[model samples]
Target: MGVVSATARSDRYPKQDRSRATRQKLLEAAVACLAEHGWTGSTVTVVAERAGVSRGAAQHHFPTREDLFTAAVEYVAEQRSSALRELPAQDRRSVVAALVDLYTGPLFRAALHLWVAASHEEQLHARVTELEARVGRETHRIAVELLRADESVPGVRETVQGFLDMARGLGLANVLTDDRARRERVVEQWAGLLDGALGD
Candidate 1:
């Protein structure tokens, strides 16, 4: 085997912004594929084509399918967290509506696919568990920040957790059903409840 210099090793991995952009593109493509077609259809070759990158380059970025999808999960979580952080000052009701919509949208759907796949795949299960915990904590932090709620208040954290659980259940039930009317009503009702609980 040939000895490799430190510079060469650094070059072997993507260290520049352009290379990072390519990796992000691949990850975005993987998320889209997972959301649109589920786990089995999100192969490395398919992701590479969707990303408009060569298969070789895709492999260079992510040598394994699991690595690609795991990174995709992290990318999605980061994107969601960033967007949540930048939520403009809005009426409490509107913010609640927006939060509910987010939990019921594409990012959650893509993650749901991974979660189901993880139920049967050990490697995926481990990755999902770790990433999910981190993402979940970040999401909770963002929600608390956006709401400006005092977690020290009685029942505050539990109430927030309840709302999240309710939103997740609504999203899961909505996968194969047309419940838009009911969903809207439920969101409005929950928004009112949350506002009251927050002393707003």
Candidate 2:
């Protein structure tokens, strides 16, 4: 009986692993599709095709379109946050650049589409709003830790928020064009400001 039970449990592991992999593929494909095509163009069928999975498989992992997208963005955001935490200690300027880079990537683009869709789609509004709030808080906390900012100090917290706001603005600007040359200058200026604002 014990051997039979062990065999059944071991057999389930591979199936579970495959399911998780399929889910991950769907999530990644959804983010890519949303970033490149925007919300209107990114349907479950589109994502499933991009993921190389059947539509039924995608639906099995994510019951609804909203559920799929919201989970996709959240998953990528968590991955980015983990990457941020793992970064080696660096100079203030390097850290500032890293934070800004977070907003300038595909994840940010996908999230912006979701935000726009949520504004007009009542069913998606609450979930996206709540997701954004949680993501925002986590990003803020990561920023503080990466910058080693003393939030207890007067104005320090505001300075960190301002930096993140500036980074987000830069991200929005990049959606229209390759704003790297201009962005680098802005990053340098912000780094100087941060150094002054967050003194040793």
Candidate 3:
């Protein structure tokens, strides 16, 4: 490979830039279809339509429903990570705060709904479970890495996870409930968990 050709290729593609736009479109479509019809009922054709792309294009990009779902899951995870990129290394509470916003936020609801619906699809259950576990393990890994959970800090993952669980469970409860105050109250409880988790 000549330097000129290599440089030209890099200039045009930049490695990370290639396929990102298409991937984003496909993921958005996947989420849309999943939310509209649930994972079991969401067909690749519907997703293609949602993305305003050819069925062949969708298939070329994803290859299979599982592939698309996994990509969508990963995309969501990446989006979450991007939001917290500026966070300082010393702050574990920032991770917790991001976790709260993630569980209770708008995009997360689509993921949560798609995931729950995915669980009921027999053909996709194992695949969905794998994706869900991947996301969970990432959260745990972040807690471990940032919080430095070791024998001395025995329960870092457990403590962070349990705190998140309460926020998540209550957040879910506010989804259909019309009372805005309830949701705000539940979200504010994170302030308490933040203090406890950060030893402040």
Candidate 4:
């Protein structure tokens, strides 16, 4: 292997404002297209048009379809992530309610779109999986520990994973059913379920 220069390595990851702006535009356009049209319909041309850039520019910024989808998913995931970034000031029940709200909210719709894209597009599959894994990483560990659920729980990552899985399933279900009040009621029920585990 050839020896790499320190300067070259440093410049490899530059912090330039223009580059950041371009990336943000690309990501935003990808999200818009993915949400509105879907993966197959959201071609590079459409994304470029949405971003006010040339198709070549979009391709240069993201060499593959996977890269573009990954950025879009990350952008969408971050919207929900802000809620959990700072700990919410509420009782566990209220907190769980808020978490449930997030599940059945706009972010969930974006994720469902991403999931659909991933299901059909091989290139986007890993990107969508990464987005889901992000949620799993953020919520599952705490949930499992709090529930006193084992980390090696069958078919899941302990308590947190089980709850998150259910939450995701319910989000999709609610979307398909278009039932909001009923979903919140379901959340209330699961909150009671977790409450049972917590010696309530």
Steric overlap count per candidate: 0, 0, 0, 1
Model 3 per-residue lDDT tens digits across residues 71-163: 776687777766555456765555555556666555566667667767676766787788778877776666555544452455655676776
lDDT of model 2, residue 143:
92
Q: 1-200 in candidate 1: lDDT tens per residue?
A: 34567767677666686798999999999998998999988899999999999999999999999999989978987987888788788887887776777667778888899989998998799888898898888877777777777899889998887887887888887777766789999999988889999885
Kindly report which residue stretches of model 2 are placed more than 4 angstroms away from their true locations once superposed: none
Question: Which tens-of-lDDT digit does each residue in 1-200 have in candidate 4?
Answer: 34577666567657465677777898887877776675667667788888888888789888877778677767766765664646545565666666666677655666677787678777777767877777667666545444445545453344455667777777878766687777778778887876655442
What overall lDDT goes with each candidate model? 0.85, 0.96, 0.68, 0.69
- Candidate 1 least-lDDT 10 residues: 1-10
lDDT of 3 at 96: 54
Off by over 4 Å in 4: 1-15, 142-157
Write one digit per residue (lDDT tens) for candidate 2, span 61-157. Answer: 9999999999999999999999999999999999999999999999999999999999999989999999999999999999998899999999999
Clash pairs (backbone) in predicted model 4:
144-160
Q: Which residue pairs in candidate 2 collide?
A: none
Find the candidate with the highest TM-score and give its number.
2
Cα lDDT of candidate 2 equals: 0.96
Model 2 residue 161 distance off true place after TM-score fit, in angstroms: 0.7
Q: In model 2, what lDDT does residue 34 have?
A: 97
**Which sequence of candidate numbers ranks them by TM-score, best first?**
2, 1, 3, 4
Model 4 lDDT, residue 103, Cα: 71
